[model samples]
Target: MNKIRNGSTVVLLVAVSTIMAIFIACGGETIREVEVVKIVEKEVPVEVIKEVPVDKVVKEVVTEYITETVTETVIEIEEVEVIKEVPKPVQVEIEKLVIVTPTPGPKVEETWVPTGTFVGVSNETYTMSGYAPDCVYCATMVHLGVQESLFGTKRGDAGELVLDPWAVSSWETASDFSYTDFKARENVPFHRGFGDMDANDIVWYFNSINPLTNPDSRNDTGGQMGGTLLETSVVDDSTARFHWDAFAGHTLFKTFTDLEEGMGIFSKKAYDERGEDWIKDNMIGTGPFQLVEWIEAERVEMDAVTNHWRKTPYVNRVEILFVPENATRRAMLETTQAYAGNLPIKDWQSMFDMGFGLAPESIYTVTQIAMSGNYWEYSHIKTGDTLERVRDISKPHVGDPYEGGGTTFDGNTPSMQQSLKVRQALSRTIDRETINDVILGGLGEEHHLGYVWNNDPIWQENADAWSLPYDPDGGKALLTEAGYPDGFDIEWYVGTGDYETQQAVAADWLSKLDVNVTFDRQDYSSWRPTIVARTNSDIFGGCCWGPLLWPFEWTSNTSSFPGGYGIGMELPQSKASFNIKNGSQDQAELKAAAVDMLQYLNDWALFPGVVQQPNAAMYNPDMISWQEMRPYLWMRLGGMRSFEYIQLK
Candidate 1:
């Protein structure tokens, strides 16, 4: 019984010990798998190996050893450390900055050589290359601004400015005559009565008046005077006109007088009026000097009218002699024939050798082809012929010249300008760029067919699409479709006065296409007739005109292009209204196409542009104070001769 009991206790002890060992092993492995862990082995409790203390004896021993046992029960412990590798973070940086703005650039600069002190007319505005351009043009510069000097502080103050006005028969008949509305009148000639309103005596130059009484009634002799006085009358017998000197093709002279003496001159009316006389012997304008003498093409002598006006014009006596040629002027300058005069372009180079004051301004003009009601119509040649056929047709239609009347068109005629496809074909066939480079010295730009300039907002902004590239292939296709697959003959008419280079350009352009073009240069009279006949039918080739801003001013069959295009038919087509309304070129879907075929060219083409011609004034060094000023923009009151600033060496 004792052995069995002993065996049972042993079994129980072994079982308990095995269970504790398993628990310890499981806990340690779990920690190691998930973390950096450490395992330590120490002794198990001593009581497990020893027998239990007796109740009475244990109590007595506990009391005796309690103090000592309690003191030694505490154990010492040390900490374990673990380390693992992980990723680090990153860093960054930055940069510097700056800013800028925009502004206008400077104008072009030029250098010139002069033979003498620059002594040319100072005028700037006459329809040419300046800030402010004009509608009219003249041979010589209109004013003295070309010399780059100010006659006074005021602009357009032509206070006896030296001008080269042509010897004209009458202002009313000739466009060459320069006249302003002095008589405060509408469509009336300027009046310069022989009277003094201001301090000085008013001696005015007058343009002829409109026909009120018969020209024969312009008799100053009145009742008596006959014989020598009647015989010397300007027109037949006598004259009541005030501008006798200018009218007589000579200088005029007069003094102020309240009462009428022989035949007193009349005053002129203001602008926009029926015609009122407003002339005074002496007048005050914004000028430093006043006209002391009224010399026609002779010398415009001015006296010191004001403080500043009298300061310069430094030379004591100023005289202007009319000699148009450059060689003559240069020769005079070289030999020092005159104190001041215009010099040749070559002689300008020699002036640098002597060291004299000089200044030069570009005095070029804008070439405008002014188109009027006179032109050919659709009734002329139909759109299906060769160049020869048209030339032959153009033969008999030439009109008379401008000197008189001889070339009036017959009531029955047709127009050749009616076909847009033909014109487009012509445009494509010609290489305008090549012409400009070769003939115009690369100074001109290639142009399209239009009314306004592409750069001008007035024409361009208002225009529709049309200014596309010259598509020769497209033109050819169009020509073929228009029943001219074989092309037709055209007599490209040339005028007598035309520049030779332009003729070459036209020939070259025609050569590119399938046509036989011929040239026939005629005199002014014959040319005039040809123009009228051509407008009436296919008598002459195309006419190239001067620079004009609006395309319509130069291109239309009647005059000027209206920005868009339309098909012109002898009879109206059913599609006319629909195409015009529904085919809004500005619409989104067709905007690009319209822009190319219509608007662009109508405002930027050859018919209207190249407004300013390339012209420059040759000058020497001493004339230092010259700031290129725009004549149109600057000249508000008068013509181009007015100037505000100038410096002389």
Candidate 2:
């Protein structure tokens, strides 16, 4: 039966092929040849196919062909049968195709080569501490040309404080803010061929100043500034990561970016070979300028670095002379003996009238009567005690109840200056408006709070609550209630500049409360250490300023006046507020906490803010032109003035 079925299938296939061939042969007159293709069926099992290997298959097919001509056509039909074995499946591997293109390198801009010299005069002199800057002013001088920091803060185009890349190219904080990684730009050279900057150099510089790494080198600025940094890890030749136990908010940025007192990256090669003593006297940095000569308190001379990575200075040389006298500094600018010089507020009107260039913005410097909140040193009296004292003592001379009594508080007893009433009394005595208008020659702002600028959003939000009204009567009443029936004798320490005059004006108002004032005049050099150590007398007057956008930077007990120099002597309220602000993850809550802290400081009367000091520099416009100056954290020196930006007109 199977053989019969197979024979019938073969016959059907042959018949179909023969018909297809005949159709092709008759279809065209053009002499064409036709062939029927093979058709295979595996249903039939022939004797040869059945014996085939298991790895292969056998098939049967039939075929036919025909030919035709134009003149005489010949048709032929044929049938053929064949069987073949199919190969088994095999495994193969394929690879994905990819196309790659090379990236173009960055275009290098031409550096500005300076040809002329720029002469500048200032009231202060450089400390000549190359690796370690002693003061903000000295640090600024180093920043001018001799040293460069990893980052710096500058005013953005939108007038907001923004982080600026300097030595480093980019930085990123970890997801949890535990660490920040930084990448150094390629080919950033160090001054005097100390070698190019790399991650190792950065790690060395950070470790050199970090107290955690080198406890013996506990310099004031380095210790306080690098307090938050835990460890620095070198990720690669060009990358470094700084780890912190906890995030310190904006201060973490400020420590590396602050124009003044920020960590300045030094050359690791130079330090190792040159030694610390040599480094202190000499400067090596990748800044726009190189130190040519430093004559201690006389002068400091610097020459431009023609191929500075960031900018080449406009002037070839900068000669900074130590002219402590305000008049000398003014004369230097007027005669073009120097192109620019520091100007006192008393000289502002005269300089402006003479058509000299005056800085367009106010500096962060605030000249205030800093009262000691050192609870350990002074006896603290409470508001209740003051009220009790007021009840016990009758009002002797009463034009206004706020006016102090004729009798003095007990000299034998240690009195509290930290009392809110005492601070209020002291704040009320000095009229800030008069100070701004008269003593400052209408050149300053009447500031009544600490750590907050009048233009700050935080200040704007809580302006009404922060305002300290001038009330001499109220001041006297508070003082009288605080048991200072007349007034107390307090030593007033002051440095040079307008502070002397401002303090004298304050003394006059303070005397109205029968407060005896003993003036201790000292040169700033002699007075600074005492003030920074918190060893200065009852009242010390100086300029203080910080980043306005970050209120906690100045208010934090761990920073600025209260923390760094023991200005408020570790006030518990400030520390608590600082902790809350630092630990808070929400920005709004942090800001609110900062403002609250500032309000608390104000209430505590840690330092009664008198006025925001005006910073002025006189320059001859015909000889030089300067871009707009931004509000600097260090008001004494204008905001990070780059000689690269300054040009000869």
Candidate 3:
């Protein structure tokens, strides 16, 4: 082996000279490499399509149709070289054997060709025939492409887009046409634009985006409702797809998006001209049902999307009529009056056993507390001379493991979180294992600070210091040192109907420390104004995480937030959170550091972590299959056995 003797050799030679002169030496790590899988990027479905039947070609179960686009942030990794040399190739003699296997050919069935018919407003412009309230969230499911502008509607309602409204407005005016002009055009003929379809064929919307185009104004960037609510569609014929709006998540989706977009967007959503509660109460959505009635926190009725492309859906439509009594919704599903939906966890099993379908979808959200200084950089703050340290005091050496589940947060504020002593004390006081096993009945999963599963590569490479260890003694010492010798009451914030196991365990453990919390919120909207909007306190508590992008979300407590030295780190920080939209990775280091710190806190219980809650749904074998799916507002129900796809059979 030969060593390079140039720029790379300076430190080595200096080290040798120093060692010889004073008998001084140090240790170093041998760089180990990781093996990688070759990803053969092969281009890798649901719903009923009007196709030739397997036997005859005529069973056209055309329910009518629709429309579709995407922005995927590219994740490219730079490979690192290891010091160890790779083994040279080894060769061996080959042996030949006679083949006993036969080439099997085919069991063939009659073919059925599927097709889609386009519906809703076609043409390049915003096409609307009759007047109907539009639900942005539900509108995203279409296979067609559409463009709406910022000037037409405001954020006070969930009608605007994700991009800048002013930017959108400027472009629209430049086009010499407003959304109204585009809306005036004649609707175009439907065509299965998305390409290749079937019943039970799963079609997806671009997370609040639709494919309906306004070619006349396609170049106009002034503005359009680029996201949130979406339009839905289905395969109509070999050449057509039907469309409508799937109305479920728009209300909440817009609320969260506004929060994520920062104060400006939040302000638009709340106090803006249209106003926040307007969207909340008006409850506009484009689904099989329309909000025909609302009684203020009471009930809602819906009518089917008219001329919804083809034969209408089954069930004669739906109604989430006010049933304040939790028991009412449960009874409705159990008795088959409401059809199907998710019920509270308490009623989950009973409904399942009784044969009602469980909404097998991603539902449970988590909240966890964690530290920032697990790494040398952030740890220095916690180990500093000043009373405030970055690392939690209880178990300074606790290893933070990554690749798992759950998120880490410092309540919702930093000043309250800006102290390591308090965070560390809280971390040590609770027992994660007990909570995981007993409280959660192991129903949920534990993750590294960023809520990444232990299987994730990031957790493997970086967060070795965040895995939690149960140690009340370690926690007590931290609390006592933090001036909470007798323990103090800290309010815990969470969503309603979150994991009960976590709350119970937290109460049990903190109670032992003479520390207690009253309760937490079940929904972000209820808790957001005070915790985030008001942004006044440091002692905020709650959890939120999802996808590979939790670090991308600002509210997450992980130091991974690129904006500021995360509150948990106890570093000098800004009083407010930073906005990092446009999917920017500019602050990646800060994000990585944030993740490191968050996980580090987890290892020592810096934040109380609950279990990972997968969006779950239960369905009767006789009715539907509750298969698992990606975390989002998506579910499949279009096969022949599907309710919408139902037949006399």
Candidate 4:
């Protein structure tokens, strides 16, 4: 400490007070440091001093203020950043492991191998050889694809009927319906190394089958085409023209295009060189198959022609086995000896339950009773000449106009009225519904008239009038009114096929009316000739017909003409209706005529239909697959119609 003087300067020291600066930052945030620098001056209190200078004491007192030096303190603030730390993830590698299993091989015994041979079992093939056109069983050759026809019928995709040119390329009909010219397809090779077919071959075929050219010809085609076909002339190498007296509507399709009626075209050179005897057992035609061997009733073997122009058979060879017994046929199918077989209607369900496929509904034929010896036509229609007609009035169902001198309903003879009542009684006694269920296994429809299917518009419209009710009492009363109070004896000509069973069913039903029925069993080969010649005196109990591409009225309805199974007899009203169907071009007029014809046929009750039978068969689905097969719908009486469409798995 220094003493204070009046004229001296004073130096002072001071204690400093410091102020601290604080910084705040949120979590995970960066902080900025703030540096504080300050310089401050502070005032200090000083004591009063009296000063006495040298050599003199001053009487006067004086007060003076003194200035002081003070030291300053500096506070500096530095900015520092604070950052939150984050941890990094770590990755580790590990070894991989795998597991394996073994597989077993298949055994050879479990595999199936194709034998390359397909067998089809049928009830019968009467003539293994298609020797002549007149042969009733010869038409099957054309259906089997061993021969070819000039024209053929098929069902279109929409199930409508379609007539196609088979061997011929194209055809042109005369505007007056008098002639038709056809151009044969080129490069059509005949089977068995025979020369190719041409216009000359076609001319020769027609001439050979016609009675006018060959007087010895006994073919039924002579009666169908004798009066209509005048001649066939060759125009060029592949063109031929047919001259006709009058080519009516559907005449070509119904006669020439029909599988049953159409004659399979043959090679002229083969006939000229091989002779009749040699050609009888051999077939020379343009088809997709070639005949290998025929063992009569045993079997018919044929080999497929590879890469055929039309269609090639899927199997290398086909064997059609004739198994007469239905049980044997079924057994053959079950044992896999036969891939397909014709089975009875009753066995169809059991076979189907065993995974067998049934025949498609489209391929079916109608079975009925066609009364023979009912010839009522007094004159020939084609010649318009008085004819010597046979009227066997001894049969109760037969009518004789010669006795009463009239032939129409307005002036019907007594015999005609009596025959009508008797036939009606026979028809009424049949329980068609029961027969359809029991005999046909409910797979058939109960039909009332021939050539009139249940689906036909005419049949649908006239179902009530056309249908004959099943009334045993009414039948008895009708028989009593017809002067047959005691039932008479009648013979039913039976044949091999489903018709045999159908006739049996009908005869059993007829027995309820006190009618004594007798059976005249015969093979179709012997029975067909008499019917074709219109000489059969007994009623054929089983008559089968099919759906034609067009309405056919000339076959059974024609007067003194060879036609279908029912052609054994002819009627006057039916003959008149035949003319209408042949002459009229309008569909409406033809349908009207058909309705009238069917009505007359129904009222006469001569040809009473029993059931619309399906040409059904059984097949093993696992062994054979017809998945994409479109069968030929016009196969009448059913054989292997579309056998070419079969495929083996």
Best by lDDT: 4
Worst 10 residues of 1 by lDDT: 8-17
Residues 1-649 of candidate 4 have per-residue lDDT tens digits of: 0011111101111111111111011112233344322311111111110010111111211122122222222212111111111111111111221211122233233122223677888865444333454444445667667777787655444333335566776666665656788878667888867778899899888776665566555553455564467778899988888887655534555456633345678888888887876776676667767777765446677777766656777777778876768888889999999988777666766776689975432244566677777776777766767656667878898877667555443327788789889888888887787666666666667877766666544566689989978888999899999999887877766554434444544465455666766665455545666765666767664332322223343445455353433456767776776666555544446556766777777877877877765454567888887643223323432345556667776
Deviation of model 3 at 531, angstroms: 3.1
TM-score of each: 0.35, 0.71, 0.45, 0.76
On residues 1-649, what C-alpha lDDT tens digit does candidate 3 reach at each position? 1011111000000000000101011112222232221111100000000100011111111111111111212212111111111221111121221212222233343232222211110001111111012221222212111111111211212211212221011111111111110011112111112221121111121111222332121111101222212322333321112121211111112222211111110111112344433533443222222334422223223333333322233333333332324465556545545444444334543454566553322333344543333321222211233231223223322222211211232332322332455565565555555454443334445543534433334455554565555567777776667566776654443333223444554565465566665444333223333321122132323333222222222323322222121323222221012122212222343244445544544543444544443323333444433332211212111111112222111
**For candidate 1, what is the lDDT?**
0.25
Can you rank all candidates by TM-score, best first?
4, 2, 3, 1
lDDT per model vs. reference: 0.25, 0.52, 0.28, 0.58
lDDT of 2 by residue, 403-510 (tens): 244233322222433244666777667677765666566555687776665544566667788777887788778878877777765555543333444554456555
Model 2, residue 118: C-alpha shift (Å): 0.7
Ranking by lDDT: 4, 2, 3, 1
- For candidate 1, report its TM-score: 0.35
Runs of candidate 4 with Cα error greater than 4 angstroms are 1-115, 128-134, 154-159, 211-215, 220-228, 248-252, 258-262, 359-361, 404-411, 499-510, 541-553, 560-566, 627-637
**Prediction 2 TM-score vs. true:** 0.71
